[model samples]
Every structure is written in structure tokens, then in C-alpha cells.
Target: MKKTFQYVDYLWDEAKAAELGDDQVALFLYRSNILGADLRITNYGGGNTSCKTIEKDPLTNEEVEVMWVKGSGGDIGTLTRKGIAGLYTERLRNLKNVYGGLEDEDRMVGLFNHCIYDLDSKAPSIDTPLHGLLPFKHIDHLHPDALIAVAAAKDSEQVTKEIWGDTMGWVPWQRPGFDLGLQLEKCLNENPGIRGIVLGSHGLFTWGDTSYECYVNSLEVIEMASEYIEKKIKENGEVFGGQKIEALPAEERKEKAAELMPLLRGLASSENQMIGHFTDSDTVLQYINSNDLERLAPMGTSCPDHFLRTKIQPLILTLDPSDEVIDTEATLKKLEPSFEQYREEYLQYYENHKHANSPAMRDPNPVIIIYPGVGMFSFAKNKQTTRVASEFYVNAINVMRGAEAISEYTSLPRQEAFDIEYWLLEEAKLQRMPAEKPLSRKVAIVTGAAGGIGKAIADKLVAEGANVVLTDISQENLEEALATYKRDEAAIALCDVTKEESIEKAYKEANLAFGGVDIVVHSAGLAISKSLPDTTLKDWELLQNVLVKGQFLMAQKGVEIMRKQGLGGDIVNIASKNGLVSGPNNVGYGTAKAAQQHMTRLLAAELGGDHIRVNTVNPDGVIVGSKIWEGDWAEGRAKAHGIKVEDLPAHYAKRNLLNEIILPEDIANGVFACVGILEKSTGNTINVDGGMANAFVR
Candidate 1:
């Protein structure tokens, strides 16, 4: 770690701090940014900073000493004034006198709530007492990988003495709580003139009267540890036999991930509901492909901080690097049994530690999966959690490697890890999460998702908490569409629906991304208006290839994967009003859509034995945001109605009995109703045309 403080930026922040009226908050924000900006110092949401200041109580009209700590659940990198919780310091310190010694963690939280200086302030961090008990005006706590590397070694105390001499204090492993706060206070009283304290198997804490002092103290300590590790590596050989192994090309690795990820996603999932994210970054690949991976990967988390995100041990799967190509089916056969074995081991671990009132064991599945020669696969209940687990595991790899360079890397004993894993403070966070949406844990595929109706369907599915795979013939449009929604929950695939190879590849990629598909919305179609006498063979063939043949291929492939998983699924085909009630110059488009509508009925009948439901959404006059109804198509429709092109929308709206202008969102609503709200009603057609009597089938 190099020093990242810039003199000019510091001066600018100082000047800006004076204008904010609260110098402590402004300085805290600045220093927190500087600390969080360096990944070497902290990973995502892993560190905290605080400042002690004075504020006037609105009700009392008197100045009160307060501690403004980083709020719980806020990331330090993007912290704002609202992200700091203000508490009455004198009152908060007085809680120790009234401590009943019952439900300490819960009582600590309640007492912190009672001591808030501002009623509207956010919740205080659980580690607030750790800062309040210290005498300094500013405090910094971080899980710097370098510090953890030194602190987690077998001879951690000796390493600490060598690196910091008498300037730092060492506290043994203790779960963060009121008790830990008391322990820290005792340590500070015993070790005079110490600049900071290193919490064994946890993190680093430093404090000062000014923000600059606290920030610089943390930097210097971490820098010293980094230098020590670097020297040890130079004296000894590379950590864990750091021999460079040749990796497959990037494209080949990506292909291998695509092939293997689906099987892992299926096997690692608890009840086939978990979503997976694959990562093959150079650092992760370097560690997983190393010769010592079998021994090192199973050695537990570098620190207890990660136990909440990642379990104690990662599941290791050995791969045959000699086989150049991946056979997905054969791989699944091997992984299926291994997944069962992992679950059994995990249950046994839980049984060994369970007491009368331990929290229910979190799904008995591994959060991190190590695939030798491939990379890492991180699994979670959703996409964001999966990404977080991946980040922590990456940091774990670095910390462990650094420790191996100096001494053998050892983690907290398994019992200590289990205690933290079941700690009520951590479990409460999960309990407070919002209820999942209707389609949570389900995966969907939306064809022709570049724009208009297809894009609308994808957005709606994501809003209801489904992982969607958006496919279109145009890559640019597909990417733009994905960017509009939750990007993590949506993926893009450039697919030409007219080709069998393209359709197959798209489904395979979707399976790799989110295990398998549970819903298919076939919205990719083309509308070409031509009279019977004027229609050519090429126009007819084009319509059939995309509108009719494409749906067949998509349904066939989607149902195959759904059947293999034995999960009931839904398929909705986007047809047209012209299919049921034909107008002049609608020979090609109408015939193809009519065939598609019949195909939906046939599929519903044939697949009902497997509990698969198929339906059709026939929407007419969806002129707004419709790419298919623009340019010549709009002009032609206007000509048929004896009106100007711009007035065609008004004319069509008036044509319906309800006189309502149908939008793409209206069509999306119908599709959503079919797949989600109307779960029991399938093998039916729902028309979204604002009551077109002529096209009514009932």
C-alpha cells in the first residue's frame, strides 16, 4: 500500500469543510472516501469510519456531545451526510451502568436507538460502541487484506511485534458486541502510547483527535505490514509454490464457463432456486489453477468478517485439465453426487454446533465453488449477493496467499466461525430484508427484446423479480435494452430466431447464466402486409421462418430443459388480431400468426401432461413505441383509412369500441397476467385490443 493522500485535494476539502457548518461530518466524509477509494485497504462495504462532535438538541436547546458513526448498511465509498448516525455520547456511555447483562446484543441495539440525538437519523452501526468507548475524536476500522495477512498467521503476535514494535496493541479473537467494546477499553488502558489495536481474526482500529491523524495512522500500519510480507516473499520462494501455470485462452475459458456453469448452477442450488454468477478474472484463475488449490482452498475464510457472506469452507471440484473440451452432461453426472456429499458434510457441521435455540441453519449449500482449471462460481439467493460473495472470496485468496508467504495461514477455529455465523446481530440483517416479489427465483427468456413489445415484456418480468435473458438480432439494441432494467438480473444474447443453431445457442447461454428457464415469451416476429395476388414466395417464406418456425424451435428447446428440471413452466406467444379476423392485404402476416396461435393450443395440449401451460397474447393497434408499426407500415395503414400518417393512431383508437390507444405497456400487462396472475388459466387467448368486437373469439 502506497500512500494515496494528495495535498491539493486535502486543501480543497478543508476549505469545503468550513462551509458545511459541521466540520466533523465534512472531514469524516472526506477521510472515509480516501480510505474506501483504495481496494488494498478495504473491499465493498467492509470498513467503517466515525467522528465525535457536538450538536444542539432541538427540544433541549442545549449543546450535547455526539458521536456521528457510519450508518449500518451504507457503503463507505459513497457515504453522504445522511449516511451518518448521530448519537448522544454521554447518554450512550451511561448505558454500561444500567447493563442488565441479558440479551446483550439486542439490548445494545435498543440502547443505541434510545441515545440518537436526531430522531430522523438512520440506524447506528452495530460496532458503534467500539468507537464510543475510545477517547479519540475520530476513529477508523478496516479489514485491510495486508493487516489480515499478518494478523491471521500462526504466530500472529510475533508478527505484530515485529511489524509495529510497541506502537500497536493486539486483542485476541472476540465477536463484536458490548463485551468486545469493554475488552477494547481495557486493552487501551493497559497499552500506553499505542497508536492502534489489531483485532486478531477480525480487523484494525485506529483513532486520533483529527481525521488526518486517524487516516494516516491506518495507512502507516498497513504499509508496514505490506512491506513485511513483501520482504518475506523475497527471502522465501513464492507463497504456496507460486509456479506459473499456462491458462487456456480467454475465449476458451469463457466457453468452458458457459458449458460448466449450468451444471454447477443446477447442482449447487437448494431446491433448484439459487442463481449463480461465474468469474474467471486472472487473480481468481491463478489461485484456483495452482497446484496447492486442493489444500489451500479448503482452509476456511481468512477472517471471521467473511463468515456471514461466505460459509466456513468452499466446495472444491477437481477438473480434468487434460481434456481440452468440456462435456457438460458427463460433468453434471459427477457434480450431482458431489453436491449431495457437500450438503451432508455441511449438515454434520451444523449438527455438531447446534444448541437449544440456534438460528435455523442457512440453506445447506456452498456460497463459493472452486473449479480447478475453470475458475470460481459464487452462488446466492440473488445476483447482488452472489457478486458480493465473489468479491470477498477474491479478497480471501489474496490474504491467504500473503499469509503463506510469511507463515502457515490459519483461520479461526471452526467453532468460533460457527458462533459468528449464527450470531443474532448478523441474522437480524437477513430478517429485515423486504419480502420477495411474485416471480422471485424464477428465470425467463424474452425473444426480440431489442425494443417495443419484447423490451416491455423483459422489463415487466424483471420488475416482478425474475432473472431475464433478453435476445435480439441486433447486439446494440439488446445491450441498450438490458441497461434500462436491473442489469444484473438481465443478460443479452444476439440471436437470429430464423436459424436453429442461433435458437439453440441462445437457450444454452440462458441456462448457463441462470440455471434454466421457467418461462418463455416468444415475441420475435415480423409483419409484412401484402395482398394474395402481390405476395411473393420470398415474403411468404420469411414470415413463416420467423413467426411460425421460430416459435416451434423456442418452445421445443425451452420445454426440454424445463422437463429435465421437472419444474412446471409457462410459454406465451405474441400473436396478432389479424390472425383471427383477417383484413385486406394481410395474406403473409395473418397466415403466419394464425399458425402461431394454433401452435400455442397444440403445445398446451401436448405438454399439459408435464404441467407446462402455453397461452397466446393477441394485441392489436399497439402503435405507440412499436418498431414494427413505423415508417411504411404506418403510411400504408393511414392510406387504407383515408387519413394522414400522423392521424393513423387517432383513427385506430376510434375504431375500437372503448376508443383507447393501446401502448406497448398494455401488451406487456397482458403477457404478465397470463404467466403470473393467471397461473391456472392456460391454453387460452387473451386479447389486448381495447375491445375489438370483430376480433373477439368468445
Candidate 2:
């Protein structure tokens, strides 16, 4: 029978390949990029490609064989020439004569530097020897789901023989170092015509005399394995034991995920604050809702790259997404103990596998969390890292599915997982990473952020390493505002603060995008100027709804997400000096500002136990770049003060104690202080009014 799914295809473009002519490095990069473009062939940063090129040596001025391989931390899909490390092939081959055997692998890494042919090439990865030792002109090492299925299966060796016979080879699990390189060379010598080798419970290696041949050989093997697995899956007739629990409705699953992510983020951040990413795609939903999920999930992932980023295992939450009775409070209470237990088990695993000189146990928290009928959440120090972890785990799930369809799936043994996780090489990599920014893992939401003070606040927060969700009532403004930022640094959510549904939806957007909120700024407000006689019930209600009620709704929803995250948070309310000083023709706007100020104090006192600080920034006049001063409000204030609308800026500046102008940027600076600097203070007011005697907090 014909299959419903597709298989990997040959993407080698002859026209484009011919354009490069005989540039071996360009051809090497081309083959690697096409292989990586389709994730079904290999995961991002999971595979490497290399080629032997004849280049003139600077010292000898003679053509010599040099190997260019993908270096440490380079993703093949995005690989450039700069990402390739070039080394003398003769030097690498010579190291075998002075080989120190299995115990001396770590020392070999430093020795590769002496083999460098160029001073500006990238830092070579540990896999350098695997490519250097082989005599082939071109080589590719990929973690394709299809080949890894054969590699991870219980009968992995037998499957390798069944799929390709003597044409491909097999070797049991070995750490990637000098010894493993020797084993691959040994495999090739024994099987002279072999075109590839399968690393048991690891990945695949294929090579050819030229780059095009290498590209086709890799694709051919992956396509063959994919067809073999698809055939067996058809014969077996069921997957994951036929899915015991049906998935929740897509929207309901999204809603449940929004509820759970914040709580999970809080639990995962016990050691260090973490950012989060969530996904409910069909791939994850299929596994988590399966009858075999309980049995298979504990088997964990079989590949090293998968587990290194996702951890040795993932945590499965008890609350099913399809549960009819959703008692949110009870669900929250029950999650605490589960997270605690997962942490305990992680510590126990570390203890069970530690070497005498193993690096200290790392954050004993789960990087990936799953729930039946819903989806998975992955957390890390930043959004991109969190997203990558999630992607790696999904790759792991596919590897398990392919392995299980034909034969039982097996994870790397505990000791092997530990060895790779705590290797001295990995410790050095971490030490080389640059120090993190102060707000590295923080997520913030700024209301009315499309313009004026809110826009400035959002800009400042992003500059300081915070991921911000910019929300405003106008969709046009919201889209325009977020255009200035990278997708990972900022996002837009359409919000109307006066409407509860709008506020709830926006908060949920924040939860799904960047984990949870650590800082909340309510800068969405409107202003009006009216004398006691002219201020009608309609004008008072309008001002109250926008200034007072808007701030209240934002705080109410923000505190809910912040509390779920369990980390302390800051809430900065953009109030004004009109609240503290009595002024003519300001009856409606002044009273509303007063209410917003008091609400800040009340919430600060109430949420103190939760460590959620509430503060206020009162700017006397921010008319220069303010959206509030654009229309009727500017005219009303100018008419009452006996000044032209254009002169209001000078008028306000001269009246202040400092006789200096205050702009929206000044208001934003005050907000940064409340959230970033004034960590010890709450329920306090910082006046950005350039000094007004009556408006002083004291």
C-alpha cells in the first residue's frame, strides 16, 4: 500500500553546484546546507560535513591535503566558510603514531590546534578526528531520524545488516574522541566497499570520492531507512499502542497550556530564573497521549545531542488536558509536590552516575515538561535556547517512534549519559560563554506600548536583555511598534484594558510567547482638562475608565501570571503629579490619577507576601512626544492655562522647580529604576516631574 507520509528527497541542485565550479569549500558548504535544510535528514547543529582539499601551505608553498570540517556550535543549515575549521590532514593522521589510547581523548582536543592550517579558522569540534582519520575526499555525519531509528533499536546491528548488508557498517556506542575515530577506520578496512557506518545508539556516517556523491549517498541511506520504517509501521498496524487518550480540542489544549506554563516556569526556576517555550503540535501530542507513554517516556531519548539539551529525561505532569473538571486552584496546588519529586529524582540520578572527578551536579530541575492530551514546555536562560531545547526533544520523540515501530527503543545507558553531560570538554564550553545580562531571563509586558511613555518603556526593557510583549488597543500601532525589534526580543498583542476578555487574552499571549511576566508596566492612559462646572458625568466616566480602571485591570491580570511563576516581580504604574497637586480645570483627570496612585499602594501591600513590588512614576508634564497630548487634551489644557497649544511645553517646563523639560524618555528612566534598581522599595513613588514642591512624596 502507498504511504500517507513523505520521505526525504535528493535536494542537490546541479545548476547551483555548477555555479561554484571547483571551489571545494563552497561545494562542501552547499552539500551541508541542503542536508540541514530538511530536518528529516538531520537536526539543527546535530550533524557535520567535511572535505579534503588541496591547498598551498604558507610555510612550504606546496599543495597539501587540508580537511575543512564544521566546527564547534555551527549549524549546518546556517553554516558559512567562517564556521569551517581547516587543519592539515597529514598532522591529524600522524597523531595516531603518538596515540595515548582511550584515557587520553581530552588531551587530543588541545593537540588539534597544532594542526591548524589557518589562523582565522573556527575552533574545531571533538568530532574532528572522525572526519580526519577517514581517507575519503568528502564525508557527512548526520543524526537523521531514519538512520538513528536503526541505530537506537534493540536489534540495531541486525537492522543495519538488513537495510544495507555489507554496503554499510556498524559499531557499538563509543564516545566521540580519538578511539572512536580509530574504530571507524577499522570498520572501513574490514569492509573495503562499505559506503557508510552506523554508530550504534548514536548517528550515521557516509562518504564518497566527491561532494555530490557524498550528498547523494547520505540522502539515499536516509530515504531507504525511512521507507523501511514506513513499511514496517504499515505491517504492524498500530503505533504507541493505539493512543489510549484522545487529545483535547486544540483551543482547549492551548488554554490549558497557558495555565500550566507559568506554574512550570516558576518551579523550573528554583535554581536560576528560566524563560520558557510551549508547543502542542501533532508530533508531541501523539506521544504524550499514547497508551505506551508511561512505559516509553521513562526509556528517555537515545541520542546524545537530544538528551544533552533536553536532559536525561522529561517530567510528565498528572493533570490531563482533557479533564472535565478544571479546578485551577487545586491543579496549581497539586503541581508543587510533583515538581519537587522530579528535582529529587534528578539529584539521585546524578549521584548514581558520578565519577570521582565529575563536575558538580547541575541545576536539578527538568528542562522539558509534558502533560497528557496537551503538549510540552521547555525552559532555559533565553527564548532561543528554550526553543532549541523543545526542537531537540521533538527530534528525540521521532527517533523513538521510528525505533519502536520496527523494534523496541533503548536509551543510552545511565553512565554514558552522565559521562557526556559532565564531560570536562562540556565544562570548558560553558566557561567560555560570555556572562549573562542582568535581565537575561526576565519577561515583561508593557501596556499602551505603541507610543509615548509605553513605547519608551518597552525599548528600555529590551535594551537591558528583557523579552517584552508590546500591547496596545490599536492593532496598527502595535504591529508598527514591534517592527523595530527582533522576533525573539519583542512581540505584539492587541489589548483593550477596559475589557476583561481583551486583558485575559493578552496575558495569555504573554504566557505562551516568553514563559511568564517578571515585570508589568501599565502606561495606557488618556487625559482631559475640565473645570468643576464643565466636567460632566460622561467626561468623568471616560477619564475614570481609561486611567483608573485600565491600570487596575492590568495589575489584576499581571499579578495572576507573576504569582504563578512564583518568582518575585515588579509592577510600575505610570501615574502623574496631578494626583498629588490640586490644579484648575483638571477635575476629571486629576481624580482618576489619584485613584490609580492609591490602587498602586493597595496592591503593593496586598502582594508583598508574594514578593510582587508595586511602584509609581509621577511625571508632571511629558507633552513633547506624548500621545495623550496629541488631540483634544492638549487644546483643553492650553485653553485653561491661557497659552497656545504649541507653547504648553515651555509653560509646563518653567513652572517646575528645576525649570527643565521632562520627556517620555525621562518617564521610561523612572520605570527602569522601579523594576531594575529599586528592588528593595515598593509602594513608593518616584516623581519625574523635575521637582514640584506639592508633588513630593515626602
Candidate 3:
């Protein structure tokens, strides 16, 4: 079902109690709607918006209303009192002008002091001052389908100019929030009185004195562009119907699928497109199943936003729209040049619009959907962007329904879209977070850390400046893990990971050790020793209890602590190597690992909406006289292989191409990477397998 999007008037009604003079409240409400729209209009939080307001002290007769902007995670549709905070506009503007920019912490404190309600909430939006600099009262930001359709096309700027005239000013896509806002401020100062802003390869933004005015401006810009594209499409929709044919058998189908995937993958710079994010979706099945495949082939991708999503075009299954034959090889050959031309044009566009010293180029196979007979498929960097682009294409198709409509839709020019897609300023936005001074003060809980990978991860995390709580099922092993770390830097807790009561107590103890728990890594898991044929129900249940059930309980408790602290947190799950790429000999262990991996992904998707990052790591092998791999079991396994127990680690390491034995430290580093202590890779997984497997399964 389509999610509802609110208008500026709806926001106006919500803030009626605040009165016009309560501009701070008004500003907060407005900012909330912008965030809401960003969330509702797309999948995930693909877009963001903000507002600025002044704050005053009722007492002292002194005041600086400043700019009360939306706090991070403050969704527009449901923004509340604490979601918006006060920021000093003059301070921000001054900082931007300084030789070196102000730190995120200082800027956060500047805004934090201005919050009217809770001080515990995250700092104001990174784009606080960017909104402050806008001359308009209301701003509307979105990755509009109509606009993206034009933005990523071959002559998008020309199309944009023809459609909007001098009324709109276009900016290359920059990472949104602060950096985009700063760049926008620069643009506004240069352009003077431009009515709206078009971010090539990104989205559209329009503003006015009121929400209605801004909304109308946004609609007008999109409507004009859509109308122009519609006219151009009418001139060439049915130029060719092409030729037609018949269907193939099941074995032939699988063979054809294998053949087409490689070609499509070859079109991509990496193995990403063929094994892209959408291979598992129903849409992929539908595209591949379509009988009249070539009917959709000649048309361009739905829109520019889709370039990163559905790709430049879907792979046509046959030469004629009515053909039922799934001639995958023939279809790929016919579509080859269009793909090559698309890449060339994309690069040229980037070069034309970019400065000499810009960041390196991104891949050019923006979108590559597959069609098996009549079925279709698509993918993108994130789930949300992919959905929006897909829907936009469907919408554009419907708009031209039955009107001699074939290839009516056009994407923004490749060069213009390329410029926006590869814009360095935008890339920088991904790294532009408010300085996390308080994050350093936060504490984390890593479960199952009695030894092995858990202990290694905890040590690495502490060294980078975070108080850590190491927990395990064994009291002696827990103490052993504690001994490996500095007493002042870490604490140890004993708890059976399989029990909720034990996890709850561990959370309480960890919370008491530090002021609050800000990060949780559930690494304790049991691996079944038997093969699937030898595995019993009890063994399966035990693995599920320790790996799957324990993770759930720990995550539940971790969220409660994070929520109470009013500061979001991170949760990392240590899944096994079998989870992502295989159905190994241990049935129970493999099943549990797979479930845990997916659970981590689902958690990240849900919790990310709350500004919390949820992710997982899949460690291949790290056996070093550890409890899980020690004693009789290790010795017996070693004897079976005709090697001493002490030689097992070396033997396993030699099996991998890198011949690098993965230490618990490597696993620990993977966890930190997920927590973004290293970089911002959320809802992802890293395999510490030393190059064991390189297939694209997940």
C-alpha cells in the first residue's frame, strides 16, 4: 500500500496551538513535516528537510531564538517537542566563514542548549544552518520521480531548462543535510532570487513563505517537467513494434538465466548488477518471466533517480514485445551498445560538469533490471531508493498508457546525472557527521566474550575510547576475557546467553558499570558438532537457543537501555560463515546462523529509523586454544586429520588463499566497522574469511 504524505496545511493545523508568534513551535512543526515527507515519499529516509526559528528566555529579558531545527531521527510526520532544537544561526554562519570549520560537538552544543524540552535527545539536524540561510519560510525536499526521470537522461539540463525556464536553479546532487545546505546557500547567494532548486541525480527542493506555497512550487516544477516529457514521448512512442516468437522449457530457462546473468554482470563494473540487491525479489521473477520482453527494451529507464535503482534499463527477453522465447543470449547482444553508450555519456557528463580535482568516478551501470520471459527486476544502493525509482517508472508507464506509448519515458541527461552522482561535495556529506564527543563517553556490552573473537573485538573497541562490558556464559572464561583487558577500561559479567532473565541481569550490571549502555554486540553462539544426518532435535534446539534466541533477548534489552538514555545506539551480531553463503554440514548451527544474520539486517532497517545502527559480522575461522575449539573435541578432530591439536589453526589458515589466520582481533575490527567506529557501513556484513568464498549469494 502507498504511504500517506501530508501537506503544509496539515502541518499548520498540527501547530495551531503554538500560535504564529511561537515561531519556534511553528518552525518545529514545519521541520517535522519535511522529515515526514522525506520518510513517507520514499523507502527508508532517502531525503531530509529542515527549518530555522528563534528562541527566547521568558525570564532575563535576554534571548537568542536562534534556529530550532529538526533533530536527527525526528521524522517529519511525527515530530514532537524534543525533535526540534535551537541552534545559533549567527554562530553557524560564522563557523562556515572561519578558516577551519567548527567541530560537530561545538555545533551540537550550540543547538542542544536551544532545545525547549529534553536535553537527552540527539543534536539538531546537521543542516540546521543551511535551512537558516534560506530566504523562504518553508522548504520541501524529495527525490521526485518526475524530476529524477529527467535528471539522469542524456539531455537532462537542457530538458530542465526547457521545462522550468529561469524559474528554477539546478545544483548537482550533494549529500543532503549540512553540506548540501551549505552548497545551497552558496547557490542562492549567487543566483539571487531563484524560486526552486533541482539537485541533479538526487531530488528536488522548493520553498515559499508558507507550507502550501512551497508545496505548490514543488508540484509546479514537477508537473511542468512531466508535461514536457509527455509531449516528447508522444512524438515517438510506436515507431517500432519489432518482431515476435515462442517459449522455452524449464532446463532451458535455467540455462538462459545463467547465460543472461553473466552478460548483465559484465555490463556492471563489479558483480553487483547481476547479483545486485534485487535477485531475491518477486519483481525479478516477473521481469524474467515476461513474454513480450522487447516491448519494454527500447524505452529509457523510468527516471534519473532510478539510475542508481532499476538501472539504465531492464534486460529485454526477446526482439518483439509479443515474443515468448526467453532467448537470453540474443537479448543481451541486442542491448549491448545501449549499455555502452549509456556509460560513455555518463562519464562525459561528469567530466563536463566537474572540477578537475573532484573525487573519482562511480560505476556507470546505474540500474540493470532482469526480465525472464515477462517477469522484471531492479535494485539500488538502499532499499528505499530502489522502491521509489521502481514506482516512478510504473507511474510514468501508466501516464502514457495506450497512447502509442513505447519508450516515452526519458531519464535526466547522463552527464548531468553523472555530475550529481559523482559530486565530491555530496560524497563528503556521507562523512559529515556532527562530532561525537559524547559517543566517546558511551559504554558498550559485548556478549559471549569469554574468549575467541568476542574478547578480541572488546579490546579493540576499548582502545578506540569506549568503556566495554564483556559477558559470557562461563564465569571463569569471562574472568579470563577480562584479564586480557585493562581493569579500568573494561568490566566482565557472567550470564547464560540463552536465557532472558540472565540477559536482563547482564544489562543491568553493565548499565551500572558505565552510566548507560550505548552499544551491544551479541557474539555468543553455539555450533552443533554433528552433520545434518547425525543432528538431533535437541542439538537443533540448543543451537537456536544460544544463537537465535539469545540474540533476540539481548537486542530487546539493549534497545530499552538505549531508548532510556534517549541517545540511540548500535547492535552488532557475530553470525557464522555458514550463514551468508552456505548450507554447511551442521544443520542446526547453519539454520541458526542464517536466521541471526537476517534478524540483524531486519533490526538495522527498523532501528535505523530511530538513528540506531544494527549490523552483523560473519567470521570464517579463528581457533586458538579457545574453549569452543579446545580439549577432546579439538584433539579428536586433529587426530582424524592426522595433525596435532596445536596445528589446527595453522592448517585452517593455509586453506584460505591469503593464508592469513583470522584472529579474534579481525572479528573485533569487523564489529567496530559495523558500529561505524571505523566508517559508516550500516545494515551490512564483512566476511573475515581470508578470501575463502567470493560468490554473490546475499
Highest lDDT scorer: 2
Candidate 3 residues 231-336, lDDT tens each? 7656754322321322355444433433333334335423232222223233333333443335654454433334434444454433333432245446556756
> Candidate 1, which ten residues in sequence have the lowest lDDT sum?
5-14
lDDT of each: 0.81, 0.89, 0.58
Model 3, residue 552: distance off in Å is 29
For model 2, residues 1-698, the per-residue Cα lDDT tens digits are 11123587567778999999999889999999988998877777888999999999999899999999999888998899999999999999899988899899999999999899978889999999999999999999999988888999999999999989889999999989999999999999999999899998899999988899888888788878898998988989987887888888989888988877888898899999999999999989888889988898877788888888999899988975665324546766878788899989989999999999898999989998998888889999998888889988988888888999979998899989999999999888888888887678999999999999899999999988899999999999988998899858988899988888898999899989988899999999888888899989999998888788889888888888887777989999999999998989999999999998999999999999999999999987799889999898999989988999999999999999899899999998999899888889999999999889988888
Q: Distance from true position, residue 676, model 2, in Å?
A: 2.0
- Candidate order, lDDT descending: 2, 1, 3
Model 1 lDDT on a 0 to 1 scale: 0.81
Whose lDDT is higher: candidate 1's or candidate 3's?
A: 1
Candidate 3 C-alpha error for residue 606, in Å: 40
The candidate scoring highest on TM-score is: 2
Per-residue lDDT for 1-698 in model 1, tens only?
23454211122254655665557788888888868777777766787889988788788999888898888877776788888898988888888887766356667777799889876677887888888888789999898887888778878888898889999999887877777777788889999889999888778999888877787777778877888888898998655676445567777766776666656666666564777777888878878877777787767885766767878889887566445334556666767777888899889989998767789987888889877666788888777777778888887887887788879788878777887788777678778878988888778999999999999998899998889999999998887887787547899888888898898889878866776788999999777876788788998999999999999999998887776555678999999998999688788889999999999999999999888899999999888898888666676667656789888788889999899999989888998898889978778999999989989988
TM-score of model 1 (CA atoms)? 0.91
Report the C-alpha displacement of residue 664, candidate 1, in angstroms.
Answer: 0.8
Q: How well does model 2 score by local distance difference test?
A: 0.89
Off by over 4 Å in 3: 1-46, 57-62, 68-87, 90-130, 146-356, 360-367, 379-415, 429-698
From the highest TM-score down, the ranking of the candidates is: 2, 1, 3
